[model samples]
Target: MMKLFHSPTSPYVRKVMACVLLRGLQGKVELVPTSPMQNPGDLQAANPLGKIPCLVTEDGTAIYDSPVICEYLDGLGNAAPLFPAPGPARIASLTLQALADGIADAAVARQQGRAQQEEAGPTPRQAAFQERQLAAIRRGLAALEASPPAALAEIGAVAAACALGYLDLRLPELGWRATHPKLAAWLASVEASPALSRTLPPTA
Candidate 1:
């Protein structure tokens, strides 16, 4: 069996799990509850960065981060490739994935900045850091609204949905739906899909 360093709150972990579910390999992967902040020995052994969503194959080969893990899973089953073949289409999809992941990155950055702000009592540096992340997130969301992914079929679409879901989980105060209606509508239209519905964060 394969082992996955797992955390329900992690968007990165959710991406891998979404891929696993989409590929119908749920039973093959064993979920190991892990907290990267705690720097667990077993997780570190598999992923030096101690990141959740690290996959240790049955043969002890470890694959890391969300994008790489998603790509790896794309190679597993014949349920149609989430990743496209080499060409302009693949490049476009990867670019969208990068943008979506950047949105997720900004959300995580704001969380870290919030923690630091809470600890240090709201310094100028903390405020600036959070503001930058928020700006980036807004820009990315705006870009998506201008042209959303077709559906939750490809890796880019999956990643975009995951990133949006993560933002909803961590930053409900954003209330992005009112502003970015198209992206919100797009998400609502496919949020019930098997891959997304199954891998949604534990939030209700």
Candidate 2:
């Protein structure tokens, strides 16, 4: 079985888990609970960049990053392609995925900054860093809401939904849903999918 190194709270990891369920590949992949901070060496061994959502294949070939892992899983089942073949539609979906991933990355950075501020002293220029990240997230959300995708099965829609869900999970105070009702509704629709519903993050 393929082994997936992941943290429960990671949106990227959640994406892979959702894809696995959607593609009916659950029986073939093993989930290994791993954290970057708690199991740095293991994560680094699997991925030199020490990222979560690394997939170690049966042959011990490790794949890092959520997109690659997702595509690999999609290939395993010949399920509906999360990513379409090369074309304008494919580019749009891939671009949306990239934007959503960027949003998730920004949100994670902001959360880390806040955590560091509360733990020890604040990191240098933490407020500025956070403001920039928040701005980027907001802009991305606005763009997505303005142009909602036609369907949710594609990689872009999955990424956008996961990004929004992560924001709700991590930074509720931001009140993103208030300003972006369309995006919020889109998220609600996507969340209805059993694959995504099964992987909802637990509330702390």
Candidate 2: list runs displaced more than 4 Å. Answer: 122-124
Candidate 2's residue-wise lDDT over 1-204, tens digit each?
999997778999888888888888889998888878765787798898888989999999999789998888878886787888889988998899899999999999999988987877766698789899999998998898899765668888888878887998999998998998888787777788877788888878
Best by lDDT: 1
Model 2 CA RMSD to the hidden true structure, in angstroms: 1.4
TM-scores vs. true structure, each candidate: 0.97, 0.95
The global C-alpha lDDT for each of the candidates, from Candidate 1 onward, is 0.90, 0.86
In terms of lDDT, the poorest run of 10 residues in model 2 is: 34-43
| Candidate 2 steric clashes | 0
Model 1, 82-109: lDDT tens digits are: 8999999899899999999999999998
